[model samples]
Target chain A: MAFENYVNSNESYTSNQFYEKLLREIPDLIFQFKIEKDNTYSMPFVSNSAMEIYGFEKDFLEHDAGPVITDRILKEDVKAFLKSVLKSRDTLTRWNHEYRVLLPKKGVRWLKGSAKPEAMKDGSVVFYGRITDITANKEQELRLVLSEKRFEFALEASMGGVWDWNLVDNTVFYSEQSMKILDLDETEGINSFENCISKVHPDDQKEYLSDIDLHLKGITDVYENLHRVKGRKGTYKWILDRGKVIERDKSGKPLRIIGTHTDISSQKEREDELKKTLDIVSEQNSRLLNFAHIVSHNLRSHAGNFTMLLDLVDDIQDSSEREETLQHLRTISNDLTQTIEHLNELVSIHTEIKIARENLNLYEFFQRTLNVLSEKINKHDVKIISLIPDDIHINYNPAYLESILLNFTTNAIKYSNPERRLEITYQLTYEKGKKVLTISDNGLGIDLEKYKDSLFGMYKTFHQHPDSRGIGLFITKNQVEAMGGKIEVKSKVGEGTAFKIYFNEKV
Target chain B: MKKFNDVFVVDDDKVYHFILKNLLKKNNIEVNSRFFENGHDAIEGLKENSKNGTTLPDLILLDINMPVMDGWQFLEEFRKIKGTLNKETVIYMVSSSNSPFDLNKAKDFPNEIQDYFLKPVCLEDICRIFLN
Candidate 1:
């Protein structure tokens, strides 16, 4: 109706001039495209804005616009652009396309062309359309796509995935990477927050729920927890789950939450390894300190004796007395060398060597030790009672086993009471899933209540026996401990002594 | 100054016993001195002396790190029976160990132990101890 009014009430221009003026006033490049009988395109009408949009002179485009227009189209999109135009012409349909173009003035720009095509009686088609400079809109759209892609890439790179939870609806949305980490197929029913929580390991659910509850209640800024998530096969993977309450109601009640799950199983394994190494280092440090104390005390005793003896040798003037004192000096010097050798041996005993173990019969080893000590046993009139079964075997280092047996049995004999007939009993039993060998002696038992702490210490003597050099039990203790065994002694003054050797045997 | 009529040298090491005996005799500081092997033997001697109405030693040289009852155990027992003794014995702890643990431990018995000495006790230490 407006067009009719304007055409009839022409001011100075005619109807064609008025229509042209209208088309040129629009903010688009309006055009009429004709496909002739030979399938060549010609733009019969084009607005003046074509010069500004396409960088073409208006007269040149109206005369022959096909070659210049096609040349300006981006090389990569030329084929597709032409194909779309032809399709629109043949189908007599609207042509709508957005494409890039290389303009003479503007280097490169995004353009949008939309037109409705109509068939004519001459077997040619025409499209009345408009083209607009959509460079800004296209750039904005591309930036949105790029930012989305960057977020996806960041999630993938961190071995983390996003999760959106709606607290009001109790629904959860998991990203593609989240599904993969949970070992879930798309069809699996994990859409509910409850269902997702069920996948948390039973042991970790308490902490996970508490962390989320705290954040939901605004007690914490973020909900974070290191938890194990159950897999499809019932195995678990450690996940560092972090989330924040993103939306809340007016009353400060959480309505929505967003979070990320990072697979931290490998990192957890490394932490465990670091902890174990620290434990081993601390253990070695303590053992080294104990060894230092032993070295200091034992060496000092020897040095002090040598000093006192040298002083006496200077004071003695009689020839026979001087000779005797010198003899004592020589004896003490030899003792000092032996003490140094023992210390060296003690230092070398603390290595982790689980090899060199042999299966040896306990009864037979005891029999051999008894046979070797028969002379001493007879001289002391000792009665030996052994209760070990012949078939009982223990896994131990053979040399250590022999030394342990010899030291303990010889100790029992040497400390036997002279008032009563000396009796030694060897018994074997099991205590707390370990083989325990008990050696009892009805002898001058030690005052264990007074000396329990230092019973097995190196160079510690508990009796005045001439043969009590205080090294046998120390060496025996070291050998037993090296073989992964422990010794416990129970004694009473003047009654008897019982030693329990607990052996660690793998069956 | 109180004269030391009776002195007890209590030690497990035979070498210390020999050295102390010669040092005392060579110095001509004559006293009725007795030697015991360890704390157990010295405690037994003290008990015997008490029972026989004999004099308890005026001075006792105590050695730590002996076989049966160590110096610490002897001091613990001595504290209980000390009130019955006729004289307050001047006790000195002599040890080969110069460890801070042993030295600090001797300081714990301020009333009982007169002093702690690191041994190979010199003639000067002997003279100072006799003076005490």
Candidate 2:
């Protein structure tokens, strides 16, 4: 008998009621769904399972299941549910599907269902199906898929490689991406942990292995280390190696290890370069600061002298005193002009090291310099001895040489000693493969011991002469240095002074 | 009779020395004046004056940027034996540098080092030091 007949024909049997009641005892759903040719849906048969699954009375659903079933189908799955049902009905075949449903009392659930449909003479279709709860299996499938997708994306985006190791057998499986990262094309595949560790740099292998040991010992959650790895060109590249003990035995011993290695060679090089550049910039910045301070002080002195000298000229009334004031004014203004000229020269001297260097004969340049200062030489009655050989030559900037000679010779005559006749000597020689030119004068020699530190410093002078503006040696030093040379001085008080020039000490 | 008994001028610039001397004379406030070309020379003069019972200047105007020793270096040397001097003297840092580095140095100078004056010291600046 049809189960509906059994229930209707033997209502008096308590087992029939017991089974009707037993349907409520279990959670499975049993029902018969039908669709009229008019496409209206209805439930022809619903056991007590309707109340358990749909939270409704069987009697109520047998008459009104059309709206209730479709509405409770979890709107997103309703279309597919209808499509599957229609296809099964039109083909007179079995309907098999898994989908989500809204159980008013149970929030929502995944139901796996199958049904076979039959057609009536009146063109009505009917189906019998059972849908059971499969929420646990569906959720497990989803979590597994999502985790797999995340791991795949991580390896792809990291542009690195993944490695898995079986600790028990000492075997390692390197993914295709991992071999590609290590630039290994052999398809025989990496088979041993020993083989993988052998490719690591000798200096990094010890630490890399220890990290894995620590992770396996349950001392660390993951093996995190950074070291160098041999790359394709036999050059070692910085690699950040990270891994974790993914599986362990009952004794908490490591069973499986998985990890990745990222190339960090370029990043490491950039960091080191930045560190070096920052150091250089800091040193140059300080030197520039000192340069600015000296320049400002020199300019201030000249300007300050001019301010007072002009004011003094305005205050003088006596004709002779006014003339004296005017004379001093001319000298002060001349110093101001020279200071500005020195400043302008420094701009070129520091930045224009590209000046042309020529093989300059020392004697030829000496004769040219003597011509420039012939008037001053005669006025001071100074005797200059040229001890340089006619063939002796040095690579030097012509303009700088001229200025250097003019400054040194003019200073020699201007600061000449009044107690004795002025005699200046020039000598050229080479020491230790370095070309040297020495200029000596019998003028009032400076106390070198006292002024040793500041002899070549800017605006430093020792003489009490009115013409000693303190700019000649400063300029001469700059010019000589620009041509890649150094100046040395030796002096004794009241006797004589000597200046030696070393032409580009290459050795 | 004059306002200042004696003054010591320590500067590298002869033009500054000449201007200062004339300014003192025109203001008619000078007595005997002593001059040193640099801080080193001034230090030596002070040492000699301290050894001999000579008259130390009542006031000293010191310039920075001298050849051998700058005003700061001179002050360092002066602080060593200033206590042995028979006379208490006031010294001023006269410089063309308006840099904060120099000014802060002067502000922290020893008590005997009186004050600082930027270049072109006029009659008024001189009177403020002597009259008080």
- Find the candidate with the highest DockQ and give its number: 1
* Residue B108, candidate 2: alpha-carbon lDDT: 64
For model 2, the stretches where C-alpha displacement exceeds 4 angstroms are A4-300, A311-327, A345-507, B1-3
Tens digit of lDDT per residue, candidate 1, span A94-128?
Answer: 99998889998898999999999999999999888
Q: How well does chain B match by TM-score in each candidate?
A: 0.94, 0.91
Report the C-alpha lDDT of model 1 over B61-130, residue by residue, as the tens digit.
Answer: 8988777677888899899889888887989888876656677889879999988887778888988887
User: lDDT per residue, candidate 2, A1-507, as tens digits?
Assistant: 135323346355555565667667667777788899999887766666667666666467436675887788898998999898889998999999988888878878888888889899999998888777788889899998999899889888987788888898988777888777676767536677776787799988899889888988988877899888776689887888888888889988889988888877899999889997786556445534544666577667767767777777777877997887777778767766765676688778878847788888878999999988899898888888988999988778888778777777877786678999999999988888888888899998888887664555533542323345355676677667666677888998888888898788331
Q: What is the TM-score of chain A alone in each candidate?
A: 0.67, 0.53
lDDT of 2 by residue, B1-132 (tens): 344677888887787887887787677775678999777898899989878878998788888777657788888888887887778788988887776767788866768577888777777787776664
lDDT of 2 at A309: 72
What's the i-RMS for candidate 2 in angstroms? 3.6
Against the reference, the lDDT scores of all candidates come to 0.81, 0.77
